[model samples]
Target: MATQTANALRFLSMDTVQAANSGHPGAPMGMADIADVLWREFLRHNPKNPKFANRDRF
Candidate 1:
């Protein structure tokens, strides 16, 4: 599942670069797994209200 997630992320980056005709894919492709894990485990958000004006989004 993790492998699939990373592959999907890489694929998305590839598609994005192709569409935009700019940006480098190496970083996004190589760091997908790390980024995925970080985002999944550490990222915080409120889909109901993204701008709560209290939580530091940084």
Candidate 2:
């Protein structure tokens, strides 16, 4: 699951950068694993309403 999540993040970031033709992809690619762990273990936010008050961001 973690590996899948990391791969998803990496590809998504790369795709976004490619589509926009801007921004740095290295940051997202490098942090994919960390992001996967955090999203799966530490961070907490409402997927339906991410900006909701009292919910953790990032």
Per-model TM values vs. the true structure = 0.69, 0.78
Model 1 agreement with the true structure over 1-58: per-residue lDDT tens digits: 7789989999999999999999999999999999778656676766798887664353
Clashes by residue pair, model 2: none
Worst 10-residue stretch by lDDT in candidate 1?
49-58
For model 1, the superposed segments whose C-alpha errors exceed 4 Å read: 45-58
Candidate 2 on 1-58: residue-level lDDT in tens?
Answer: 8999999999999999999999999999999999989987888777899788888777
Model 2 accuracy (lDDT, Cα):
0.91
Give residue 12's lDDT in candidate 2 (0 to 100): 98
TM-score of 1: 0.69
The candidate maximizing lDDT is 2
lDDT of 1: 0.85
